[model samples]
Target chain A: MAEFVQLLVSGLATGAIYALAAMGFTLLWQTSQTINFAQGEFVMLPAFIMLSAIKLFGLPLYAAFGVSLLVSALLLGFGFKRLLVDPMIRHGVLPLVIATIALGIFLKEGVKLVYGAEALPFPEALPQGIWRFASVSVTVNDIGVLLLVFAMVLALQGFLSRTTTGRAMQAVAQNPDTARILGIDVPRMITYTFLVNAALVSVAALLITPVYLAKFDNGESIGLIAFIAAIVGGFNQIRGALVGGLLIGVIDNLSGAYISAAYREAFPLLLLIAVILFRPQGLLGRAEERRV
Target chain B: MTRWLLPAAVLAVLIALPHGLKSYGIYLLSLWAVYAMAAMGLNLTLGYAGQVSLAQAAFLGIGAYVSALLTVNGVSFWLALPLAGLVCFAVGILLGFPALRVQHHYLAFVTLGFNALVFLVLRNEEWLTGGTYGVEGIPRPSLLGLPTQSPIGFYYLSLGFLVVLSFALYALLRSPWGRAFAALRENPTRAESLGVDIRAYTLLAFAIGSGVGGLAGAFYAPLVEFIDPTPFDLGTSLALLLMVVVGGSGYFAGPFLGAALVMLLPEWLRFSESLYLLLYALLVMVLMATCPSGLLGLWAQARERLSRRRPPPPVLETRT
Candidate 1:
């Protein structure tokens, strides 16, 4: 029972990051209607930037994280969408997706060229070690992850429901044409959406890099798994992404703990395939109507 | 006369390609053939069928491994090639069941998952694939009692097979079946209304596409003289897709042009590893932004412009 609880906690911790990434991915798709394959790369590159800043200037975590978020939001996310993504959107979804994939390789390779291939240890942010409750012990990082995610979710809900900018973004997401006619600057809103997405993922990277170590391909793995999480949660529903990400994270931990270690990688994918087979729309996703 | 002239000229160049080239040059040309053939296969599904499969590399890997194993055993390379394609085709069909259920992004994820699964299996399953070391000692094919041991002979052999299979693929794409595939792409509901079995045609597209990918893999194994899990990863799959896109997806010659550019450009760049990939990625974005239609599209645009600028030739009206 203790072991199970421990696994569950760790799973939830990992799932927290997955949820954050997935939510951002869902947001991008919701507003943009384009599947950005490099969404994961964004999650990855920002963390590296933060780490590089920390190393180069010896800044504190908060300062490094803040700077990284700004750079990613301004230069990578906003600038990238305005310059490249918006134009590609005119062509169709496929080209945009492929362009993102190329961007993914570019980002990953760019980091590789700079940092070399080895994984670097991120500076410790949270207090290390465990808190014991009977036979169950929980790490501070795990607790931090859960709290951070919850805070972000609550904040996102508030922003979406209560703020004018968030509401405008939501309106654009629902129908860009209608929103455009309503005199909302749709393109600007979309770029803002990307900005919000970059900020969310930057937070995720900050939380995750300490646990996993900063690596070039960190974004690729999480981005993909989180994508599965979003799909499982029902891609169209933002809330569903939260549920899907947690579920995947828990499943990942449980399988790694209880199942054959050698086959740990296959478990989430196999689970995803099974879930998709039964729930084609995902756990929280509404079924998309087949168009003629 | 003009249509035949282009093909004839292209063929003359291709046939003369291996001659006067060093062994490495021949190898690069052979790789071009592989990528071109594989990109053509991917185009059949993506361009014509409107399905986005991110698992082209997995099928290509499957083809390579199967052919590698078969040749390592006493089977002829000749026999192994089709057999490899057949295996990939069957796997592709099996994959179509899950694939056909989803739409858009979901479909992409499914193929991506398939790629991940295939890659993981290749890495972990040591007995059959020799794990990370990869399967080496893959034998070359002998055709018509000719010794294909030499680099030139092997290059020609691969080229000959590529030419034949590509023409066959072209014919297949031009057939009534191809028309059905096109109709599905244009309007699936309308195609279904016309009594086209959408599911069957989709599966058929997967089958044909994977078979071609497998054919490329078959050649890939012998040419590289080894096989590993790296080239079959998602990046390579994306590269294959990029090649088709960069070449112009829907056009027949697009994959060929795209493949040649992708495979040869890096070698021509003197193999500055980071520089080549960086340029390739930049090129993809620039191309996507400026000319989403790809190289073939660019050529068409140029030709259209030139013809427009030139004074119109006097038209002779033929009375039918």
Candidate 2:
């Protein structure tokens, strides 16, 4: 019972990170119908940026984070939009998908060439120590991650429901043409979606990298798992992404502990195939009527 | 006479080309042939049928391992090669089942997940796959009354397979089956209305394409004399996709040209060392950004423009 509680706490912590990463995917899919295949790479790049700022430039942790977040919002966010996504959007989905896959390779190779391929220990961001309740014990780091993720989720919910810009973004997602007719800047909103996605992924990177380590190829696995999470929860709904992330995290942790550790990664993939096969609409998503 | 002239000249070049190259160069050419064969399969599926498959590498890996395991245990390479194709053809049909349920991006995800799953099995099943130690010492097959132990001999063998595969594909594409595939790509509903069996053709597209990919892998196992899970990962799958897209999907000659660019361009850019892949990625990105249809598509575009500028041939008329 105690061990189970410990596993659950850690699972939720990891699940929060996945939720954050999955949010980027759902956001892009929601707003523009663009699936960023390089999303894993997007999450990966900012960790390197933050690490470089701190190690090479001698910036403080908070300042380095700020710089990394800002760079992400610009380069990965706006620059990615203007450079790759915008030009290819005119073509159909295949081209865009191929381009994003190419972008992922470019990012992975670029990082390897520039930053070296070795995994590096990340600087501590959350508090250290353990909390014990009877036979159950949890790391402060896990608690810190859980708290931060919950706060961010609430803040995002509030912004989406309350703010003018947020509502405009939602309108654009609902109907870009109608949004345009109502004088909302659909293009700018799309850009904002990318920016918001970048920011969310960067934050996820910051939280998860310490546990996973900052490696050049980290995106491949991380991106894939988050994709599975989003799909399992529900591809179309924001709430679904969150639920899916947490669920995948817990499932991954429990399976890794009780099942064969070597095959833990395979479990999520199997779940993904099952979900796709039986429930293409996803657990939280409603079925849409198809027109011939 | 003119049509024969082009093919004859091309054949002359293919025959003469290997004799001039050293062992390493010959090996690269053979590798190109193998990859080109795989890309042709991808072309048939993605280009003609318009189904997106991210699992071609999985099929290739399946073929490689099957042939390797069989041959190393004393089975003839000839028998093992076809067996590999058969296995992949069956598996490909199974994969196509999901295509019935999902379309486009959803299908892409399903295939991608399948790829990851296959990769995991290949890596973890240590007792079966040697657990990354990789199977080695695969023998080159001897044809009737001839030996292919030499690099030059093997190159010809690979080339011979490629030629046969090409002719087979060409004939297949010219048949009704080919037209059905094109119809499926253009519009499934319209094709169904026209009495084309969408379900069977969809399965056939995957089966044949994957069968070809498996054949290429059978060649790959002996060509490299070893097998590992590394080359059969997502990277190679993406690289194969790159070959089809960059060469111009749906074009008959696309895979060959695309395979050459993908295989040989890196050799030419070897001076950059570590930066070669980065540079290659940039080039592909720029190409995709400017022209997603690929190199042949560009040629088609230029030809269309030139023809548009040219005056029409004068028509002969009979007196009323």
Reference-based lDDT, each prediction: 0.82, 0.85
Candidate 2 regions exceeding 4 Å error are A289-292, B1-8, B309-320
Interface RMSD of each: 10.0, 11.8
Question: Which prediction has the highest lDDT against the true structure?
Answer: 2
Report backbone clashes per prediction: 1, 0
**Model 1, C-alpha of A224: deviation from truth (Å):** 2.0
DockQ of each: 0.46, 0.46
| TM-score, candidate number 2 | 0.94
Clashing pairs for model 2 are none
**Residue B147 C-alpha lDDT in model 1:** 77
Q: What is the number of residue pairs that collide in model 1?
A: 1
Compared with the true structure, what per-residue lDDT tens digits does model 1 show for residues B216-284?
A: 999899888889889999888988888888888777788888888877776766577667777777777
